[model samples]
Target: MGIMGCCSDFLQRVKPYVAMISLQFGYAGMNIISKVSLNHGMSHYVLVVYRHAFATLSIAPFALILERKVRPKITFSIFVQIFVLGLLGPVIDQNFYYAGLKFTSPTFSCAMSNILPAMTFVMAVLCRMEKVDLKKIRCQAKVVGTVVTVAGAMLMTLYKGPIMEMVWTKHVHPHRSSAPETTDSSDKDWLKGSMFLIVATLAWAALFVLQAVTLKQYSAQLSLTTLICFMGTLQAIAVTLVMEHKPSAWSIGWDMNLLAAAYAGIVTSSIAYYVQGLVIQSRGPVFASAFSPLMMIIVAIMGSFILAENIYLGGVLGAVLIVVGLYSVLWGKYKEHKENKKSKVMSLPLTLKNSEGNGEGMDIKDEDEKGKKANSMNLSTSDDRSTIKVRFPIPEIPMKVEAPNA
Candidate 1:
C-alpha cells in the first residue's frame, strides 16, 4: 500500500513537468515551420491568412463532432469575447510574429516571445484581474520578476553588444549584397521584424488575459475555439487581400506552399489547440505556460547547430534571464499558495478573535489571552508588513468536467 501511494505521488509530480515539456516542443515546432516557410519566400501576410484558414478548417469539424450530441448554445456575448480574443491573438499576433520572422532569424523571434508572461502579469494587474502588495514577499517577488523579465527582453532586442556585433560580422555574411544602400535597407527590414514581434507579444499577453476572463462565462472550450478561428479566418483573409498587393504573394493555388499552409492550419493551429484545451482541462493554464521558455532554448540550439545561424551572447543571457523570471514568478506563486494554506489552517482562531469580541470591555487577562490567541493564529510575525494577500476560498476552484470522447 505504501509503495502504491508513493508511485501515485510520483506520477502526480511528473505529470505537470511532462505536459509542460510537450507544450514547449509544440511551440518549438511552430517556430521551425514558420521560419522555414518564410525562408521559402512566403510573405508574412500570406502566412497569417493561411494559418487561420488552416486552423479553422482543422478545428471546426472536430469541435462539432465532440459537442454534436449536445451542442453548446452560443450566446452573443460569448461570440463578442471570442471575436476579440481571436483578433488580438491569432490574427494580430501571428501577423506580427511572421513579420518579425521575416526581418530577423526565427531564433531571435522566439527569444523575444519569452517576455509574454511578464507582459501578461502587468496587463492582468492593469485590468484589475490581479492584485499585489509590495510589502508582501510574494508581490515583491512578482514585481521584481516581471521587471527583470521585461529588462531581459529589452536587453535581447535593443542592446547590441560587442559579442552580437562580432557574431553578426563573423558569421552572417549576405552573399548577394547589391550596394551599401541596399544593405542598409535590409538592416531596416530586420528592425521592422523585431518591432512587429514585440507588438505580437503585447497582443498575445492581452489575448491571454481576455481568455482567462472569457473562460468564466463560456463552459465549452471547443465550441469557443471553433467560433474564434472561424471569425479570425474571415478577418485575416480580409487583411491579406487589402495589404498583399503583389500578384505572386497572393497567388495560392497548389504547391508545397499550400501544403505548408495546410500543415500550419490543420495540425499546428486546430489539432494542437484541441490538444492544449484537453491538457489545460486535465492540468491547468499555468502548467501549460510553464513549458514555454523551453521553446526559446530549443529554437536557439536548432538554429545555431542545424541551420548555422549566429548565437549572440545577449541572446543567451536574455534567454537565461527570461527563464529565470518565468520560474521566479511561478515559484513566487507557489510560495504564496503555501502561505495561504497555512493561513487557512490558522484562520479558525483569527475568526474566533473577531466573532468572539464581546460588547463588555474585557479584563487585562482576557485581552491578553485574546491577543495571544490571535498571535498564534498568525503564522507570520510579519503580517503587518504584508500589504497584498491573495485569499483563495474553497469555492473558487472550477468543478471538474468529464473528458469528451477522444
Candidate 2:
C-alpha cells in the first residue's frame, strides 16, 4: 500500500509515458518469473488456485479499509458479471496459459501472448465500442498494427523451422555422427502445447475486451480488480477440487511444489495484478495492451540466459513482427498525443482573445459614456462573437461499452 501510494504520487508529478514504461517492465518480469516457476513442474490448476488466493488476500484488506463505504453493493447482475470475469480471466486465462507452457515451452507461450492487443482491437471494433477512420493516419496505423501482430502470432505458433545451429555454437558443441540430437520433435505434447497456447492468447484477448467494457460502468479500477480476484479464487478452488481429487494428484509434499506455488501466488498473482491495475488506471487500456509484445522480448532474453532455452528462427521472425506492430501502434498514439497538445496550444490564444474582448473591459472613450449606457441596456446585443468556442483534448471514457461479463 505504501509503495502504491508513492507510485501514485510520483505519477501525479511525472508524465504518463514514464509510468507506462515502468508498467511494461513490471509485466515482463511476471512472465519471466512465471516461466521459471512453470519449469519447476508446478501443476497449472494448483497455480491458478494459489494465484487467486494470494491476490484475494493481498487486495481484500485494501477493499475493506479504503473502499468499504463506497464499494458497490453486490447484486445478482453484478454477481453474474463477476462470475464471467472470474471464469474468463484468472481461471481460463491462467489455466490455459500455464497448461500451454507445460505442453510446449514458456518462450512459445510468451510469444503467442503478443497477439492479445490485436485481438482486443478487433473485438472492440466488432462490438462497436471503437470507431475507425480509415482515412486518418492514427486509425490506419492501428489497423496495420493489428494485422502485423496477428501475422506475428501465426509465425510464432505455426512455423517451427530447422534450428539455426550457429546461434548455439558457442554455447554447446554441435552433435555429429557420434551423438544423436537430444530434441525429440515427435512428442505429441509439443504440438498440443502450441495449440493450447494459441487458444490461451485468444481467451485472454477476449477477457481484455470484456474488462474494458466493465471498467466503463465501474470507475473504481482497484475495487473491480479486488472483486475479480475474490471471485476467481472461488472458481479456481472449485475446479481444482473437482479435477485433482484423485489420490495420485493429491500429493503435495515437495519443496519444488511449494516453491512453485508460492511464486505463482505471491509474485505472479498478487504483485502482477496490482501492477496491471495501476497500469490500466494510469494509462488507457490500449496503451497497456500494446506493451504485451515487448514483454515477450524480455521473456525470450531471460529464458535464453537463465534456462538456456534454445532460440528458434521462427521465434525470431515472430518477435520482430510483433515489435514492429507494437511500435506502429505506439507511434500512432504518440502522434495523436502531440496533435492534441498542439491543438490545445493553438486554442489557448483564441480562448484568451475571446475572454479579453467579451469578459474583460474593452477600451472605450468617456464621451461614449452616454452610448455605453444605451449599449449596456441591450445586454443581449446582436454581437454573436461573444460565444467563441475552442476545442481541447478528448476526455477519458471515450464511449459507453461495459466491460465484458466474461
Candidate 3:
C-alpha cells in the first residue's frame, strides 16, 4: 500500500509535464499536415472552420459524459470570456497561423511560435497568474531562459546558415517532386506571413493567460474546451463566409484536406486543448507555454524528413539554444516549487484532536535550548478536533574526543 501510494503520488507530480510532451507532438503533427493541406489550395479560413467544427463535435460527448453534473453554470460573464477565448485562440490565432504556414514552412512557423513562452511569461506576470521574484535564483533563471528562447527563435528566422546532414537525403523519393513549392522569399511572401505569425503568437499567449484565469471559475477542462471549440466554429464560419465566398473553396474531395482536418480536430484541437487546459490549471500559463519550443524542434525534424525541407545550420544552433532555455526554465520552476513546498510544510500548525469535537491551536517555535538542534515537529489531530502540539526535542550533537597522539 505504501509503495502504491508513493507511485501514485510520483505520477501525479509529473502528469503535467507528460501531458505537455504529448501536446507538443500533437501540435507538430498538425503543423506538418496542415501545411500540406494549405499547399493543396485549402484556404486557411475554411480550414479553421472545418477544424473547429469537427473539434467541437469530437469534444462534446466527452464533456457531456465527464462533466455532466459537475460542470459549473455558464454565467453571462463567463460565456463572454469563453467567446473571447475562442476568438483569440481558434479564430484569430489558428487562422493567422495557418495563413503564415502557407507563406512559410512548418519549421519556420514553429520557430516563430517559440516566441510564445516569452510572451506568455510576460503576460502571466502582468495578469498575476505567475510570480516574478528577481532576487531569487529561480526567478532569475526563468527570466534568462525566456530571453534565450526568444533570441534563438529570432536567430533561426533571420539566418538560415549552412546545410546540415540529414538521413532522408540519402533515400530517393520516387514520384515525389524533388523540388518544393516554397522558397525563401518572392511569391512565398515571407514578410507578410511573418507578420501574421507574430500576431498569432501574441494572440496565443494572451489566450493562455486568459484561459488560466477562466479555469479558476469554470474548473472543468473538458467543458471549457468544448465551449471554446463551439464558439470558435461560429467565429471561423463567419470569417470563412466573408473571405472565402467561393463554394468550390469549401469543398473537400477526399484528399489531404480531409485528413488534415480530421487529424487536427481530433488529435490536436480536442485532445490537445483538454491536456493543455489541465496543465495550465495545475501549473500556470508560463509553465504550459514553456513546452512550445519542443514543438519547434519536432517540426524542424519532421518537416525536413517528410516534406524535403532544408535543415539549415542556424536551425541547429537555434534548436540547441532553445533546448537549453527550456531546461533552464524547467529547473527554475522545479526550484520554486521546492521552496514553496518547504515553506508550506513549515507553515503548517501542529494540531492535536481529542475525542470531543473541539478545536485547539498550537504554536511550533524554533527555540535553541542548550545548543540542541531541532529536527522535526509531529502534529496529530484527534477525532474530536482537539489540537495537541508536540515539540520535537533537539538532537544533541556529539563532540568528538581529541585523539591521543601516539
Candidate 4:
C-alpha cells in the first residue's frame, strides 16, 4: 500500500509534464503536415476555417455530454470573452501562423515560436496574473530566462549560419532532389515570415492569458474548448470569405489538405485546448506556455526528416539558448511552487493552533463558570443549614429542660 501510494503521488505530480510533452509532439506533427498541405496549394484562410469547423464538430459532442451537469451559465460578458477568444485563436493566431509557415520553413517558424513563454510571461505580469519580485532568486531566474529567450529568438531570426548536416542527410538528399524543387525564399521573405510569426506568437500569448481568465468564469474545460472552436469556425469563415473569395481555393480533396484540417482540428485545437486549459487552471499560463521550446525541438527534428529542411548552425545555437532559458524559467517556477506549497504547509499548523487556542479559551471560560456555579450552590446550602439551626435551637432546649424537671 505504501509503495502504491507513492506511485500514485508520483503519477499525479508528473501528469502535467507528460501531457505537455505529448501536446508538443502533436503540435510538431501539425506544423509538419500543415506545411506539406500549404506547399500543395491550400489557402491559409480556408485552412483556418476548416480546422476550427472540424474542431467544433469533433469536440462538441464530448463537451455536451461530459459537461451537461457541470457547465456554467453563459452570460453576455462570457459570450464576449468567447468571441474574443475565437478571434485571437482561430482567426488571428491560426491565420498569421499559417502565413508565417507558408513563408518560412516549419523549423524556422517553430524556432520563432520558442519565444512564446517569454511573451506569455510578460503578458501575464502585465495582466497582474503573475507576480515578480527581483529580490527573489526565482524571480531573477524567470526575468533572466525571458531575456535570454528573446535574445535567442532574435539571433535565430537575424542570423542564418552554415547548414548543419546529419547522418541521414546523404540518403535523404537524393529523394528531395528527385521531388519537385521549391523556390528559395529571399532574406526579405524571411523577415516577413518572422514578423508574421511574432504577431502570431503575440496573439497566442494573449489567447493564453484570456483563456486563463475565462476559465475562472466558465470552469468547464471541454465546454469552453468546444465553444471556442465553434465560435472560431464562424469567425474564420467570415475572415476566409473576406480574404479568399475564389470557391476553388476553398476546395479540399482527399489529400494532405483534408488530413491537415482534420488532424489539426481534432488534435491541436480541440484536445490541445482542453488539455492546456486544465494545465493552465492548475499551473497558470506561464507554465502552460513554457513547453513551447520543446515543440520547437520536436518540429526541428520532424521537419528535417519529413520536409528535408536544412538545419542551420544559428538555429542550433539559438535552440540551445532557448532551451537554457526554458529550463531557467521552469526551475524558477518549480522553486516558486515548492516555496508556496511549503509555506502553505507551514501555515496549516499555525492556523490549526489558533483555532485550537480559541476553542481552549472557550473551554476554560466554561469551566470557570461551572466552578463558580458549584461554589455558589455550596454556599447557598451552608446558609440554609445555618438558618435551620438558628430557627429551631430554642424549642429543642426548652423541651429538654421540662423533661429533666418532671
Residue 173 accuracy (lDDT) in model 4: 75
Clashing pairs in 3: 352-386, 352-387, 352-388, 353-381, 353-382, 353-386, 354-386, 356-384
Candidate with maximal TM-score? 4
lDDT by residue (1-406, candidate 3, tens digit) is 9999999999999998888998899999999999999988899998898898899999999999989989999999899999999999999999999988888789888877776767787788887878998999999998998889777766766666656656665563433445455465733486667778889989999998898789899988888999999999999998889898788998986899999998999998888766776787789755886687788878977887788776668867876776677667777887887898899999976533333333233443333212334465555444443433454445569999998999
Q: Which stretches of candidate 2 lie over 4 Å from their true place?
A: 1-40, 165-188, 248-250, 283-291, 333-406
Of candidate 1, the 10-residue stretch with the lowest lDDT total is: 359-368
lDDT of 2: 0.69
The top-ranked prediction according to lDDT is 4
- Report the alpha-carbon TM-score of model 2 versus the true structure: 0.74
Tens-digit per-residue lDDT, 37-146, candidate 1: 77888887887777777787777877778877666566888778888987997789988888888778777888788788789889989999888998998888888888
lDDT of model 1 at position 228: 79
Distance (Å) between predicted and true CA of 287, model 3?
8.5
Q: Comparing candidate 2 with candidate 3, which one achieves the higher lDDT?
A: 3
Q: How far off is model 4, as Cα RMSD?
A: 10.4
Question: What is the lDDT for 299 in model 1?
Answer: 80
Worst 10 residues of 4 by lDDT: 384-393
Full-model lDDT for every candidate: 0.73, 0.69, 0.81, 0.83
TM-score of 4: 0.79
Candidate 4 residues lying further than 4 Å off, grouped into runs, are 1-19, 174-185, 276-291, 349-406
Off by over 4 Å in 1: 1-15, 69-72, 162-186, 253-256, 340-406
> What are the models' TM-scores?
0.75, 0.74, 0.77, 0.79
